[model samples]
Target: MRYKRSTQERSLTSPARTTAPHVKKNVDRYGTTKLGKAAEKGDLEAVKQAYEQSPDELNQPDYAGIAPLQKASLKGHAGVVAYLIKQGCRPDVQDDQGDTPLIDAVTNGELDVVRILLKHGVNPHHSNSNGQRAMDFLE
Candidate 1:
């Protein structure tokens, strides 16, 4: 005999359950730069040190075409995102998939990071290679 599942269990196994595509796309790529790694980990201090050691690398993308800002936004690292923007990292920089930090933050449900990007004047209407706008990811 089959037993009825609780609401929480049903939710966990529901067809509505979904993972952000960008999270899967970027997480498996271990070839990120030092800044990208620190940003992904949300280590603001380490990000600062990494930037100090190589300021020019701040806007550089890793082998996966993901930059530090994108990683920070992906992981909802609001402070790191703020710091990167303050230090002149382009808020609209797109990865190989044409996703900006704004797109990354929105897709990952990082509201704070999304707010930070918007407050800093990121282009919300920018579309990724898939032709989806950042606002399209809002739940």
Candidate 2:
């Protein structure tokens, strides 16, 4: 399902000069913010920079409700996942499909990311919208 941002919704890619603060912004048309892109690429430094610019963006979801943490988890970026968790990103946050970071990591066979998420206390038994739990994906 594609989500269309309303006119009032800001884009994270918007120029930094914009004065509006506190308004949650959507990612670009691709459903990824600078932070999300950085996380997806396993660029920890870029993630840090993007996060520092907008702390709130840490938990902000893309059009599909996928947060940067989930993106990192999907790509098996253990360092990025750890850093995001340290930055207060919710480990159990669900995407539009109700898949959490733990689920993403497990589904993608990202064992290291899975370990980090488990160590952080994410719920392994948590189920997605389809009733599939993280443990269900375990080998």
Candidate 3:
């Protein structure tokens, strides 16, 4: 069966942007901040600029609670993921769906990303909200 996109996924794919007068403004409308989008797109220079401006952006999650590292990992951006991890982004942080970067890597068949995450000590046995472990998705 085909699963529908989660709220987070929907946000990730959307491109609409809006700002409220009394609320904080987001960097983008895709459930991500500027840094998150940069990482997802594998724009190393943008990621570097964002990081240089705010070191905390490396660990900060977007509106959907998906961190820059997770976005990079999900998109198979090994360089971005490695850079974020080096900046102290935790690889095991779970999104709203409880999927870690390692789980995302495994789900997307990102062998290189999976290896990078593993080398950084991301837990291999951790399960997602669906109770599926990273290894369960392996070929």
Candidate 4:
């Protein structure tokens, strides 16, 4: 015989989910960098300044390996994502957990950002360390 679960029982039995370790480190690192700040704010000018002063910053990841593209994409900054891509940023660049900008945009429900990332040829089939794809995050 099988038993149906009560609402309280169901809630208690559900597994607790947490952000990956590197993702938290990425967040911490992002809040302290000019490029990460610019990307989070969608500030193209600041981004350009950072890039001009050090082109390598574009590809520079936080200690946790979150790049500017990932930061911009996570914040739903379509303009920043576009400009970064135009300036040679790789859309498919992944964080330590294998989460790409496309995954970030999709997870955030940023449709415009998703379109921009897709236009840049981000792989839709890519999965993160948890094995979740961009589509998995879609409503």
Better of 2 and 4 by lDDT: 2
Where does model 3 exceed 4 Å of error? 1-23
Deviating ranges (above 4 Å) for candidate 1: 1-31
TM-scores for every candidate against the unseen true structure: 0.77, 0.82, 0.79, 0.76
Candidate 4 C-alpha lDDT tens digits along 37-130: 6887899999888777656567666656688999999999888999999999888999879999999999889999999989878899998999
lDDT value for model 1: 0.81
Clashing pairs in 3: none
Q: Write the per-residue lDDT of candidate 3 for residues 1-139, one digit (tens) a residue.
A: 9987534312334334222321224456544667887899999999999888767566667667788999998999999988888888888998878899999999899889999999999999998889989999988
Model 1, position 74, has a per-residue lDDT of 96
The TM-score measured for candidate 4 stands at 0.76
Cα RMSD, model 2: 7.0
Task: Kindly give the stretch of ten consecutive residues in candidate 4 with the minimal lDDT sum.
Answer: 9-18
Model 2, global lDDT: 0.84
- For residues 7-120, could you state the per-residue lDDT of candidate 2 as single tens digits? 453445443323233534445665567898899999999999999987878887776678899999999999999999999999889987899999999999999998999999
**Per-residue C-alpha lDDT of model 1 across residues 32-58, encoded as one tens digit per residue:** 567788998999999999888767667
Report lDDT (CA) for all predictions.
Answer: 0.81, 0.84, 0.79, 0.77
Clashing pairs for model 1 are none
If the candidates were sorted by their TM-score against the true structure, best first, what order would they fall in?
Answer: 2, 3, 1, 4
State the weakest 10-residue window (summed lDDT) of model 2.
15-24
Please list the Cα RMSD from the true structure of every candidate, rounded to 1 decimal place.
13.5, 7.0, 9.0, 12.7
In model 4, which regions exceed 4 Å deviation? 1-32
